[model samples]
Target: MGCALSGPGVTPEPTFSKEKRGLDLSEETECAETPEPLHLSEPQKALIRESWKILHKDIARVGVIVFVRLFETHPECKDVFFQFRDIDDLQQLKMSKELQAHSLRVMSFIEKSVARLDQVEKLEHLAFELGRSHFRYKAPPKYYEYIGAQFIQAVQPILKEHWTPEVEKAWESLFKYLTATMRRGFYTEEKTAGSGGKSPCSRKAGAGSTPNKI
Candidate 1:
């Protein structure tokens, strides 16, 4: 729904060469508050959505490569995803339908989130639901930042000259909101469970997962 699941598009690769190994995406700042929803100006949302449209052209390549690069950057977290764990070969895993299917699901979430940016209530609800689902699967907060970073890297090439300061800021802001909301969901459930309440994700499997649309 988000991106076509076809061969890698012919977009020129971004210049994320070895020189960017020490890429400090953290340098991009954000709102300091935690439990708050991510705030964005209309212009920022426009820039982010427009940028995504450009990258969406090759979301299959971008999504799969994000997983590859993420594992490259943080291999310790590989086992978290059942589809990725126990793979003797990285290249083979990247091409697997399992990975592609999972990637499409993630892309779908991004597509939905971007499309609803103008509707704060809808966007926040969507984000909270996603965070709530993933929290059940034991995804830590850092995964958001790392995965988002890989995504940014994947799309940087297609963004090219249009990836301006405002665009970068917009992405950083949106990503930060995603991470914060997810963390919020994780902790909220933890608090609920601690107080002997039935957390929505207590069902064990598919508790905090994206809906079965992929």
Candidate 2:
């Protein structure tokens, strides 16, 4: 259940602007007008629960194996991996074995976290923090898409024999939920700052702006 590898922290300086504040307010208003309930179909919830049971039954071994396989396939993503100590660094590097190890560790942490997917609030926060981490690393948002795809690719093979159409649907549903939740967190933070209270964007904007290490 522990992370397999650890890397430096990558925290990005938040950005904000008075001019952009209006835009943020508009966005917040739109979001407020929208009704976004965590509405999952019964089948979707069942699938996620079943997958959790299967994965959690052997979380440590499965998580490590998934990480190892993913790194083996996408060796280039190593640079995005952050060490625990360097979590706040924003510098990017060429792909390397060290990066690969770090990537695996991040995956390990994610897998362990995913086992607790039933806790919607915690999972949402984890996704947001992860998004922030990715931003800190200067990784393109497409990397999140890549991670999702590669994760399914790496896991499906092992899961295929035992996997059902329901399981596939469940994973797809889960991914969508996680992605939306993360994006919502980002938007909400932006909206909050636009309304005048302190925000990461605002904090990074002023002279006293300081990044938070994850």
Candidate 3:
């Protein structure tokens, strides 16, 4: 899990409702019915399990690629990310030799996390929290769509040969699960706010008045 950063004083208005945001799967009709429990053949199960390992490694690799591309293609977005300077510091942290060691640690964590198929529930919870963190950063909801597209684009070339229909299906399923979880978290925050609850770092009006980095 990423460390939580203290937010800036500027509280950007929510760009969109949870329902309108990217990856929303709140509509009951939108969720693919939990498919009949797959009774996978031994070989098929092995293939899927192996494929998941590959996916884990590939996602991390692609994350680096996407991060680089984002910095290059939309420096403005980078600026927004760094408005509070924590994002900038984290980027610097990732560039250090220590990052290679940290990557290994994170990879180990990923392996353990994925060891059980039943752990998907926990994974969903993590994703939801990550989404809330993104909101705390004042990232526009559309940024998720942009990042997702960029991730797919980055991986397509490398995955072309191994990207079977099943692989696509698996990723789609994983993303849908994540999206639904995020939507739930977003709405929960909104409800809490409406009820006069405060976030840990609620911003004062006119805080974060710094001009956007763009």
- Which candidate has the top score in lDDT? 1
Query: So what's the TM-score on candidate 1?
Result: 0.72
Model 2, range 72-186, lDDT digits (tens) per residue?
5544343444442232222332233454465556555566555655555555556665644543353433234444544555566566566776676556545644444444344
- For residue 209, what is the lDDT in candidate 2? 17
**For model 3, where is the 10-residue window of minimal lDDT?**
1-10
Q: Which whole-number lDDT from 0 to 100 does residue 177 have in model 3?
A: 36
- lDDT of the candidates, in the order given: 0.61, 0.45, 0.43
In lDDT terms, how accurate is model 3?
Answer: 0.43
> Could you report the Cα RMSD, in angstroms, for every candidate shown?
12.4, 12.3, 13.6
**lDDT-superior candidate, 2 or 3:** 2
The segments of candidate 3 whose C-alpha lies over 4 angstroms from its true place after superposition are 1-48, 55-60, 71-76, 83-116, 198-214
The superposed Cα distance between candidate 2 and the true structure at residue 119, in angstroms, equals 3.5
The per-residue C-alpha lDDT of model 2 at residue 160 equals 58
Residues 71-172, candidate 1, lDDT per residue (tens digit)? 777775566676667775888889889888888888888888898776655665666667657646655444576766667767777789988878877776
For model 2, what is the error of residue 141's alpha carbon versus the real structure, in angstroms, after optimal superposition?
Answer: 2.1
lDDT agreement of model 1 with the native = 0.61
Error of 3 at 25 (Å): 20
